[model samples]
Target: MTEVTEAGVSKAGVDEAKAAMREIFPETPLQMNEHLSRRYGADIWLKREDLSPVRSYKIRGAFNFFRKAIAAGAKDRTFVCASAGNHAQGFAFVCRHFEVPGVVFMPVTTPQQKIDKTRMFGGKFITIRLIGDIFDQCYAAARKHVEETGGMMVPPFDDRDIIEGQATVAAEIVDQLPEGVIPDLVILPVGGGGLSSGTTGYLKDVVAPENFIFTEPEGAPSLKKSLLAGEPITLAKLDNFVDGAAVARIGDLNFAALKTFSADQVMLMPENAICVTITEMLNVEGVVLEPAGALSITVLEALGREKLAGKTVVCVVSGGNFDFERLPDVKERAMRYAGVKKYFILRLPQRPGALRDFLNLLGPDDDIARFEYLKKSARNFGSILIGIETANPENFAGLVERFETAGLGYEDITENEILANLVI
Candidate 1:
């Protein structure tokens, strides 16, 4: 393995890679987001990697790896990669661009939309294999195929070449900014730490190390845990809600590049909090972001306006391959996180006019989104699972007060993960 120096990655190598990338596609935009700047009272710019051909910065790494390998006179014309999301699409697109044959292994559980997109990008240059039920299983299959066929394997984030490729994002940021204007902070979303590692590696040389803020999904804190442990540590369990950024283990190469940073510089964003940003961006700016893509922007709420006010910040919006079918779920999670929506179990007496009585307890703005009786045949009383959305969070308090006045027995299961998952 090549050693990652304390000096970080190569700036000249990244610049050269960026130059090669221009032959395939133009640099993604680095626009100052007026919506975010106004809301946070900061000069907030977004590096719109989401607008890339593959809809993510993953293409840079994939393209660079393949480009370098071909230039080095590798005999194997076939490449294999295992990915369920952005990386797969990026690899597929690059394979088509280079006119090289490639094999892509993806989890069978991956959504049809993603599968279609990957297939569309790869076209005749790639063959899609729907393998195991999870990413690990698919990755194993890809590795086995590579070993059997003596084909080159393009790892998602663990290789030095991939890291250098991703560093092009940082190079572009520096060039895109106005002369003499240095950003106070650069916020990056970490999955396996590839983007964060590469961006920070280059930015740390030009900007202060303290100016970089790394954001990871709260359910998947691979980089945060690695930083605290002083080495890489795999998580036992990870919620895949932020699918693009929910990596259980940080890549060894990527981590080596990032290990110098303090844990305080990393922020863990709640899955629901990210959903709020996704919904806000979609509704307000007409910008769609996958959960991982929203992490950098969502962490601004955690940092607060006081800390961000008058500062210039650059947030990398990593991907925009969001499935619109999940929009309702995203909105529900966002509303719940914002405290304007809740789920509860009500013990309603199984008597005539009981339902009508409960209806009167709701405030004018409070609307029942879901209501179902658990035990409809219960003689005296039955448990009713209810979901309510209100204009104001405080309206729930008044409604609960009315429920108490009516002597209705209820249990709030809004924050009860176990019960909410089971019943709600």
Candidate 2:
């Protein structure tokens, strides 16, 4: 199929997809954000997909899938899916809307909160099954069940139907833009590339995709690695912190849809930096954003003032299914990335007044967030675990200087993943 056709989902087809969803939910807002716009010297509009009924754009795809399947007289067939997060909730909500029987397969290790939310969304319309220890195993079981029962399986981001369903997001973005205002750049967060591919297809006529920038989490750079290698490649390792957009590999159909794009268009955002964005949005704007949801906005800093000056930019805020229970973790990561927090193992002289001397060296703005005597390594030296938070990142220069002047031996463990994960 020609790129313009989008594997047969045209712009009109995208509009039709949008119309199909009016029965269940309204169009999401595309508000011009004054805060971001002023900060970056650009007119920044946010395509807030986080505002959907399911608190994400996932519902749009699932709802469209159900509509098309039911229209084809497949409503009587049992539907199935395998997911532990947003996709599951989306599928469940769509199942209830159509009054269709459905099943969701999730890993045994999936968090209880996710399981309960999926059950709540599906209600009486769906059944939950916990299988296997990881996603791949659970997904295999889901596929096997589909084969045995001839049930339809709703894939997360790997099918033409799912991509077509996601294309509706672009249609809405076009409809929502202010009169006579054309977007200079469109920032999209990429995972399996469903949203990016779908939106790219829909915007072929309306906007030049040369203006597009796609972002993925640094630890899970499937798309970027794939693009650089000139084909889709699986990541050697995956980080589930940005769960929504942290895929080990890009989907076949979705990759095909985006293969023509240059590798340079795709950028990687550090997972820690994304957490910083999350915390900043929560504290400064009263906006709660999951790491993936904040991807598009967070990458703006990487673009800096030169590229964004006097331009109109649109950022797609994909999902906001953040759990407040993870707030402390998020804050810790944010503080580290911003350089205002540090963890260190100080080789303190074993003396009655060593702690007092260390405390005196810290400035008024510096606070000892965590202090623990790890071990008495020698007769003369003890290892102390210390976590310090300062008002400014620059304060670290002064801190290290003070330590050297006092002849205090220290090792910063703030960026030491293995130790930080174990202790902090």
Candidate 3:
């Protein structure tokens, strides 16, 4: 392996990388958020990585990788990478900026919006291949392509150069802080562990590792699982809804960079809970966030105001490449997580007043979101698939209590994962 010093990847090298990034874009804003501060009773700041040219800090790593690689005499190298979302755009943006030829391998399941944005960023400088259903499979395709074509692989988060590039985010954060305002806690969202590892590695001296909380999608807790296992581990299944941070396995290099931290430092954030934060930020603050971008912020509630009281916390709002088309689904998930929405199968009587009786059971705050009959399963018994939206979540308890008291049999399908996916 080429030494990182030769690749410009030391602590001072990260500072140099940040300075070099000015050619592509200026420093992303580090703004103190009064709304979150008041809500959590703590001083909360946002490292707005979402405001970058690619709408993510991934650009930093990509730019640094290319800069160091080309500078170390690989100027004519053809680069390739595999990514589900944010990293693709970053690699594309850097490729275009350098006028370098490159190819991006993306999962077939990646959002169309992300694919389009990546093409828009790379322009004529890059080619995109939709290779597999998941990032890991896509990554394998990318690697195989690299070996066949003899092209340099610009790994998304698995190389020393990549980590060094990502470490520039830490440099920017420290530089952008207000005078005498040291952060008490920092929350980072982990996908393949590049950002968390790089940032923590660079801040090893300044920020105590215990003060950092690394977050992962609850459905894909690779970092936490790896920490417990003492080595990198691949997840058998991964939920791609949080596409930006949904890696099946944490990068070996990135995991090595983060191995010092205990498994307890990793927090698994529920995918639905992240949706709650996304909807809340969009509705209350007009800040759009993809599920992965909302990961750091969503964990704030889990930490509670008590843990955050009087402390200075920095949340990295990592990316904003959210597809508006997914907004309805996101809102639905959010509402369900907030307990203001539910789906159930009501045993409605087929008699004339039977429907009216069931309707009468609902409180004034409840509204029917969906009312559908799923065929007659038995004599005079049709499965009434009903979705309810209410002002207060508690109203459903009353509705369910009434149903049981009246000898009406029903099933709450909201928490039934299989039924929720198949029918709801």
lDDT of 1 by residue, 1-424 (tens): 5434343567778889999999999999999999889888999999999999988999999999999999997635699999999999999999999899999999999999999999999999999999999999999999999989989999998887888889899999999999989999999999988888888878765779888899999899989999999999999999999999999999988888888899999999999999999999989999989999999999888998999999999999999999999999899899999999999899999889999999988889999999987985367989899999999998988998898999999999999999898987
Clash pairs (backbone) in predicted model 1: none
Ranking by lDDT: 1, 2, 3
Residue-wise C-alpha lDDT for candidate 2, range 1-424, written one tens digit per residue? 4345554567677788899888899999999888888888999998988898888899988888888899999989999999998999999999999999999999999989889999999999999999999899999999999999999999999887788888888889988997888899999999888899999888887778799999999989998888888888998799999999989999988888888888899989998889988988888888888789999999998998788989999899999999889999899898999999999899999889988999999998999999898888898999999999999999999999999999999999899999888877
Best by lDDT: 1
Worst 10 residues of 1 by lDDT: 1-10
Query: How accurate locally, in lDDT, is each candidate?
Result: 0.91, 0.90, 0.88
Best by TM-score: 2
What is the full ranking by TM-score, best candidate first?
Answer: 2, 1, 3
lDDT score of model 3? 0.88
TM-scores of the models, in the given order?
0.97, 0.98, 0.96
Show the colliding residue pairs in model 3. none
Over 1-424, each residue of candidate 3 has an lDDT whose tens digit, in order, gives 5224322356877888889999999999988888899999998999888899989889988998999899898778789998868888999999999999999999898778788999999999999999888666898999999999889999888887788888888888899888888889989999988888888877777788799999999889999999999999999988888988988899887887888888998999888999999998988889988788899999899999999999999899889989899999999999999999999887766667888888888899999999998877677766799999999989988999999888887999898999899998
| Clash numbers, per candidate | 0, 0, 0
- Model 2 Cα shift for residue 118 (angstroms): 1.2
